[model samples]
Target: MDKRLLDILCCPVTKSPVRLLAENELLALNRAIAADQVLNGAGARVTGAFSGGLITRDARTIYRVEDDIPVMLADEAVATSQLTDFPRS
Candidate 1:
């Protein structure tokens, strides 16, 4: 991801600052089983967000990652809380 781009990205819902997780960090986060893991829409997996993944502490909304670029459009994000509950197969 580009710093210039990241400097301009914001959370979809809160419109707040976002942090980009490293690939390994994302992988580890993806592996986490939140207390409500089974209730999230995307399930408990970080595959959707990785080195190129952007997250806001307010919520786990994830913008799309394409070509190593994170799509920070509000409409293109998935909440982290919502994503941290899917069963990985």
Candidate 2:
């Protein structure tokens, strides 16, 4: 992600600052996805793992970056609370 874009992007719901997910954090999220345990705010299953992502500062939600494009849709945000073992920053 571009520094300028990351600086400007914020969580659509919380309006909180967003930061790139750390390697460990991304791994944990992917593990949860593989278990079929990750879900979007809209209650839809997150069937695919993110190659990259931005997470809200509060760690409440995450927006996936696919092919270098950020999926900023509110409904597409994955709730961290749904993960069995949520990663800490």
Candidate 3:
């Protein structure tokens, strides 16, 4: 993701600043998705793993990046709290 774009993007729901998800964080998220344990805020099961993602600065939510495009919809946001064994690093 471009630095300028990241600087301007914010979580659609909380209006909070957004940042790229760290490698470990992405790994943890993917792990959960692989287990079919992750869901969007709209209660829809997340069927695919994210190749890239933007996480809210507060770390409460994540928006997936597909084909290098960020999916910023609130209903598509995945709650970070839902992932078990989330990596701290």
Candidate 4:
């Protein structure tokens, strides 16, 4: 992800700034995904592994990045609260 683009991108719902998910955060998310414990805002099971993600500044939601494109749709957002042992810092 480009720093410039990231700097300009914000969560569509909260209007809060977003940043790239850290390695630990990504790991935790993927782990949950692999275990079939992840779901999107629309209440659909999130399948497969994500290459990367953009997390809201408040750390409440995560938007997946597929093929280097940010899927910034609200329904596609994943609530960070669902992941067990998710990173805090």
Candidate 5:
């Protein structure tokens, strides 16, 4: 995604700032978001912010990538296998 485009994109539901991910850390599962580990519920993750492609720390949503176009529509988004609580080990 382009830096100019990322600046304009926002969460379709929250209309809040959206950032990109590097290292494929922000996984897109079935067009939704997922992550192996996220630290918190409220904080945001940008990776490189402008350089990386769009992703979020919530791990429940993804800015859909379509034909080199980002469909940042909230309605088009879905959730991955939810892991609300992590085991204390």
Candidate 6:
């Protein structure tokens, strides 16, 4: 992700600053996704693996990044609280 773009990106709903998802966190999320255990805020199952993602500073929400573009829509957001064992750091 570009530094300038990331610096200005924020969660659409909470308006919280966003940052790149960490390696460990991404791995964990992918694992859950593989198991068909992940869903978006809209209650739709997230079937595809994210190539990259951005998470809110508070770690409450996650937005998938596809082809270097962040899917910042509220309905597309994933709530970290739903993950069975999400890493906070």
**Model 3: colliding residue pairs:** none
Query: Model 2 over residues 1-89: C-alpha lDDT tens digits?
Result: 89999999998777999999888889999999999888887889989989999999899888999987899999999988877687665
Please report how far candidate 2 places residue 23 from its true position, in Å. 0.8
Compute each candidate's TM-score over C-alphas.
Answer: 0.53, 0.94, 0.94, 0.96, 0.49, 0.96
* lDDT of all predictions: 0.55, 0.89, 0.90, 0.94, 0.46, 0.91
| C-alpha lDDT of candidate 6 relative to the true structure | 0.91
Which ten-residue region of model 4 has the weakest summed lDDT? 80-89
RMSD of each: 6.6, 1.0, 1.0, 0.7, 9.8, 0.8
The list of candidate 1 runs beyond 4 A from truth reads 29-51, 57-59, 83-89
Cα lDDT tens digits for candidate 1, 4-69: 878877875678887676565455455553322322233333333233567664545656567877
Candidate 6: the clashing residue pairs are none
User: Between 2 and 5, whose lDDT is larger?
Assistant: 2
Q: Which sections of candidate 3 miss by over 4 Å?
A: none
Per candidate, the number of residue pairs that clash is 10, 0, 0, 0, 1, 0
Give the C-alpha lDDT of model 2: 0.89
Of the candidates numbered 1 and 5, which has the greater TM-score value? Answer: 1
Clashing pairs in 4: none
